[model samples]
Target: MNGNTERQFATNVYYDRTFDCDAAKILPGEFYYTGQDMLIVTVLGSCVAACIRDRVTGLGGMNHFMLPDGGDPASPVSASMRYGTFAMEVLINELLKAGARRENLEAKVFGGGAVLRGFTAMNVGERNAAFVMNYLKTEQIRVVAEDLNDIYPRKVYFFPRTGKVLVKKLMQTQNDTVAKRELDYASRLKVEPVAGEIDLF
Candidate 1:
C-alpha cells in the first residue's frame, strides 16, 4: 500500500493502543505505523523530532534527528532523518508526497536538550529549536505547537488522526545529566561524526 493508505490503516486500527517506551517500531531516525488510534513515538536527546500532520486529513508522521546535518556521507539514510536540515526537508517532502498539501501541513517540534553534562546547556536546544522554527517560517509551513528551550528532556506524543501533540517535561536532575554526559563524552570521543554536505546547524 502507499504511504497514504498506510496512514489510513494506522488511524483506523490502532488509535487506542499504548505507545510508551517501546511502542511503535520506527527504524532508527525514521519511523511510520498505522495509528488509526495508536500514538506513534520516538525518544530524543541532543536530537530533534518533527511531527508533521495534514491539517485536514490528520494523517501524520514523526521523524527523529540527531544533528542538523543529514545526508552526511558518513550518516546513512537510516540515521539521516536524525539530522536537522535533512530531516526537515525529508519530513516535509514525505508529507507532500503522501498527499499532504503544503498549505495545510502543520508541524510540531520537540527535543534538542543538552541532556549531557559538561556540555554547555548554552542553548543547543535553542539553536535546534530556532533552526526548525525558522525553516518552517521560510517554507511557509505553519507551526501549530512548540515545546522547546528547557533544560530538562521531554517526551512527546503525536496523535496522527487528530494532529494533537502531547508534551511531557521529563525532570532530569543534575544526577541524571551527569550520567548521560559521561556516556555521551565517551561516544563523542570515540565516534567522530562526519559532517554532511550542508551544515544545517
Candidate 2:
C-alpha cells in the first residue's frame, strides 16, 4: 500500500479504538516517530528538537539533541556531531522506513535557548541551532517553521499527521527545571568518550 492509504487505514482503525490519545513525551537524546494522530511532546532549553514530517505520507518524528562540543571537527559525520547526528539520522530514517519521501520532508525546529548562563562562552544554544539548520539544509529538507535561540525554555507539541506544531515559551522561574536538566546533560557529554570510536585502526 502507498503511504497515504496506509496512513488513512491506520487512522481509521485507531480512531475507533482510541480517540484523542495523549501525547508521548520525548526526553533529551531521544526521538519518537509515528503516523498516528497522537502528539509528540518535549520541553527544551539549550537542547534542540527537530519535528520532521513528510508532506506526502503523513509519517513523522521528533528528536531532542545536544551537540557535544570538543570533538574533532574533521572527524566522520557520526563523530563530529556526536549525539546530534545520531538523533537526526534515527528520526529521518524511521520516517523513511514508515513511507516518508525524502524530497517531500518538511521540518519544524524548536528550543536552543540560552537559558543557562554558565555556558555563555560555549554558546551551546546558538551552536545547536546552527548545526540543525545546516544539517537539514545539507540533507535537502525544507524547514517549514522554527522558533529558536532565545533566552527562555519552550514546550513543543507536534502533531505528525498534519505537520502542525504548537510552541509555548515558558516563564523564567527561579527553579527552571528544564534548563537545569539540559545543562546537566551537556555537562555529562563533556566527560563521556565518543561512542563507536577506537584508536587502533
Report every candidate's CA lDDT.
Answer: 0.57, 0.74
TM-scores for all candidates?
0.66, 0.81
lDDT of 2 by residue, 1-201 (tens): 221110111121122223266567777766788887778888998889999998887888888888766655345464437566656776787778778888899999998888877765667788789889988997889999999998888989888888888898888893278977777776666665544422210
| Residue 135, model 2: Cα distance from true site in angstroms | 0.3
**Candidates' RMSD to native:** 8.1, 8.4
Per-residue lDDT over 121-150 for candidate 1, one digit per residue giving the tens place of the 0 to 100 score: 344455567667776787777887877666
- Alpha-carbon error at 59 in model 2, in Å? 0.8
Give the lowest summed-lDDT range of ten residues in model 1: 1-10
Per-candidate clash tally? 13, 0
Task: Give the number of colliding residue pairs in candidate 2.
Answer: 0
Off by over 4 Å in 2: 1-19, 72-80, 193-201
**Model 1 residue 32 lDDT?**
60
Candidate 2 global Cα RMSD? 8.4
| Candidate 1: residue 96 lDDT (0-100) | 69
